[model samples]
Target: MMLIDTSVLISMFRDQTGRVAERLSALVGDGDLYLTRFTQMELLQGCRDEAEWLRLDSYLEGQTYIEATDLTWAEAARIYFDLRRKGLRVRSVIDCYIAQLALENQMTLIHNDRDFEVIAKLRRYRQTTLDTVRSTDFHENDQDAIL
Candidate 1:
């Protein structure tokens, strides 16, 4: 499984030719896309208006959602402190939680955030590269792209 991050979701929602959106299309075709509550909350928190909120909510409803266990929170705390001890501070505790969720589930994170790069270096979780789709010949009828 591949965990979807809020950064990727936001980019996908705003841009159709970006790395995150294109990667999402491919991953969805492979049946490897996934999402956690952490990402869902983060995405919902960024909605600018009711229309966007409903749109995001509807899109998320079609996704497979996962929950982080208590043990995952414990690991997240441990990771936060460990990074702090090494003089690395992630911008948000939610990022730590999401990273731990991906680690515990052994899923490759599909993200556009660089903070995950810091966490990945220490935690050793798998990640997939996202490259922008620069061509103009994108498939308009693709369900994944529409999502």
Candidate 2:
């Protein structure tokens, strides 16, 4: 299974040509999709108005969202401190939580955010860029030029 991050979901929602979303859709189509609570919260927070929030709520009704437990928090704390000691300043607590979720679950993360790339390189978690996934398809050669 793979863990998806909020950045990829937001990009997908805002751009139809977004490779992240396309890959996510492909994963879902293949029955290999999973989501963390952190991702769900981030996506919900992007709703600007009540109507949008309701729409998002309705859309997420059947989705499964996983939460980071106490063990995950301990792992996140360790990761946070380690990254800090290495002079890497993660921008948000959410990023740590997202990374922790992927790490603790032993899942590969699919994200477009550079933050994930940094975390993957430092922490040894696996990650793949949307561009790389898109490149697997002949029709997706224009992804980089999309937006």
Candidate 3:
């Protein structure tokens, strides 16, 4: 399974080449998508207006949401301190939560944020950037056409 971060979701909502959106849709289509409660909160907070918030609420209404327990928060705190000691500062608590969720769940993370790169490198969790997913889609499409 893949845990999606809020950065990718926000980017997908903003950009319309349908790049990140398509990638997320592909994951959902393949039944490989999972979402954490932290991600839901972050995405909801990202909306600037009531209309956008309502839209997001409606969009997420039927989706599965994973809850982070006390264990997850404790682990995230450890990850935050560890990264801070390494001179890699994560800008938000939400980032740490997302990283910890991916680590504990053993799920590959799909994100467009650089913060996850540092966390992935340190924590040894699998991660893929938006560009990586896009290029992968391109390659897959090329192979399909050839076949």
Clashes of 2: 0
Instruction: Encode model 2's per-residue lDDT on 10-81: one tens digit a residue.
Output: 666666555656667775566556777766666676676778888877777767776778788877777778
For every model shown, the clashing-pair count is: 0, 0, 0
TM-score for all models, in order of appearance: 0.81, 0.78, 0.79
Candidate 3 regions with alpha-carbon error over 4 angstroms: 26-29, 132-147
- Candidate 1: C-alpha lDDT: 0.71
* Rank ordering of all candidates by TM-score, starting from the highest: 1, 3, 2
Local lDDT at 5 for model 2: 68
lDDT of each: 0.71, 0.66, 0.70
The residue-by-residue lDDT of candidate 3 on 1-147, one tens digit each, is 788776666667666576767777775567567787766666676566778778888877867766787899888888888988888876776778888887888888888777777787678887777765442222101212110
| 2 against 3, candidate with superior lDDT | 3
User: Stretches of candidate 2 above 4 Å error?
Assistant: 18-20, 27-29, 131-147
Looking at model 1, residue 85 earns an lDDT score of 92
Q: Per-residue lDDT of 4-28 in model 1, one digit per residue for the tens? A: 7766665566575566566678765
Candidate 1 ranges with C-alpha deviation above 4 Å: 16-19, 131-147
By the TM-score metric, which is better: model 1 or model 3?
1
